[model samples]
Target: MLFQILLTLSIRFFLFDFVLFKSLRNHLKTKGYFFRKLLSCPFCQGFWSGLGVFLATHLIAYNLSFLLPMLSFGFVTAYLSMMTTAIFYPLIDKFEKNYSTL
Candidate 1:
């Protein structure tokens, strides 16, 4: 459970912070209404990425039981992890910057 949450959070951060965000904002900038809208906000992209990670982890772990309950739990876990990541993002960014400088 703990590993799943951490994995989901890490995947979400990588997707939103490194991959999807840059690709959407730069290469695909304003190319489409949907892409533009999605690129404009971190939370929106984060939520989807989080949800995807959670669902993927659950599926891989073979933890799926009740459809609705599992879906709900995954979503909740995703959101919480995403939010937790968001809260720590700035601190992590600063640490990375300081480390690179050193």
Candidate 2:
């Protein structure tokens, strides 16, 4: 469970906060105002990344172990990762602020 959360969190951070995707994000922004807005919001990023994580882990678990439950793990993980990512975003922001010149 913790691994899922952290993996989801890292996915969100990489997609939205990392500098590697700066060009992609800019292209997305140019595509539409909504795309730009979604890319800028951690909550939105978290939701999408969370869902992605859930689907990935779910598929693996479902195929590997025939004991997967009927729980809404996808949505549950989405919300959980969303909330956690939002909570941790400020710390990430602070790091960028402090070392943006480096």
What does the lDDT read for residue 27 in candidate 2? 87
Q: Write candidate 2's Cα lDDT for 2-90 as tens digits.
A: 79778877887777768778789888988988998888766566667766776677654545342333134445555765676667668
> lDDT at 50 for candidate 1?
51
What is the per-residue lDDT of model 1 for residues 18-88, given as tens digits with 9 covering 90 to 100? 53356556766568887766655555665566567666655544444645655665676556755776788
| Whole-model alpha-carbon lDDT for candidate 2 | 0.69
The top-ranked prediction according to TM-score is: 2
Q: Model 2 Cα displacement at 51 (Å)?
A: 1.8
Show where candidate 1 strays beyond 4 Å. Answer: 19-25, 40-42, 58-65, 92-102
Clash pairs for candidate 2: none
Candidate 1: Cα lDDT at 60: 44
